[model samples]
Target: PTMEDFLQPGNKQVAAGYVIYGSSTMLVYTTGRGVYGFTLDPSIGEFCLSHLNIVTPPDGAIYSINEGNYNHFPEGVKKYIEYCKQEDKPTKRPYSARYIGSLVSDFHRNLLKGGIFMYPPTASAPKGKLRLIYECNPIAFLAEQAGGIATDGKNRILDIQPESLHQRVPLYVGSKNMVQKLQEFL
Candidate 1:
């Protein structure tokens, strides 16, 4: 197919989801309504209903980011990291930072558990790394449907126009308030 085929916006995406294979095989996905999970019942060899109508909270106790490149991140991101670790009692200070490096895995955990996952543009890669059409857009769609938000540190992830088939943009997606907090620093 031509590049035009991938020019569709995130809003136009029909569906997006993923499967997690660990102690149990579970399929999680969304169709713009809400997130849901189905577990594979090995005993019966069939998927069983597990999590349904999943809704992420406005704020969560977790924060996910690649701290290894902390020196390469922008000042805004650095401050946000500090904010997450603040010892404030009201906003749940010192939020747990979870970064496993796998986009799908880390994002899946944050999606279901409720938190922020940020992949800001570093010093070397100013455009960021995650592809817009395939990765950011689809996840942004699900984030919104699940009562969350997705952004590229500034604009809405779904609102960004695709300039290329494999466009990369900084990603920040998670609970509504958490995302907003991150944007404040941006």
Candidate 2:
């Protein structure tokens, strides 16, 4: 396909999935229906369905971000980080910080256990950093289908019109309520 053809928006994608290689190989995918996961069984030499109709929780007490960029982040993002560090019992204000530095791994954990993963625009790269097409879009599609949400602070990730094949965008994806709450800070 031509480069232009590859720049289509996320909605144009009929299917999206990722294979995470670790202690166990896993394949997760979606087709606007529901999210499913399969784990490769070495003995069987085949992928078997391990998770079915995956659904993300509406709220979470985990926050994932690279704190090294805290100083370079926008004031809103900084404020949000501070808010996440505060001690509040009823609402779980003091969220556990988890940053694995791998988007797919972090997102996969949150998709199942519930949490928020953030990569907002920084002072050095105000436009943000994650590739919109290959990285953000597919994950965003799965998040939405799995009863979660994905946005670049303001706009929904799936609704964004791709401007370039390598366009980068800020990402805030996770449990529905956590993501919506992050919007207030954005």
TM-score, per-candidate, Cα-based: 0.96, 0.97
Give the per-residue lDDT digits (tens) of candidate 1, residues 1-186.
Answer: 887788877878888988888889998888877888899999999999899988888889899999999999999999999999999999978899999888877777777777999999998989998999989998888889889999998888999989998999999999999999988998
Q: CA lDDT of 47 in candidate 1?
A: 91
Best by lDDT: 2
Question: Which tens-of-lDDT digit does each residue in 1-186 have in candidate 2?
Answer: 788899888989899999998999999999989999999999989999999999999988899999999989888888888888999999888999999999999999999999999999998888999999999999999999999999999899988999998899999999999998888987
Q: lDDT for model 2, on a 0 to 1 scale?
A: 0.93
Q: What is the Cα-based lDDT of residue 62 in candidate 2?
A: 90
True-structure lDDT of candidate 1: 0.89
For candidate 1, what is the total of clashing residue pairs? Answer: 0
TM-score: which candidate is best?
2
178 Cα displacement, candidate 2 (Å):
0.6
Give the runs in model 1 whose Cα sits over 4 Å from its true position: none
List all candidate RMSDs to the true structure: 1.1, 1.0
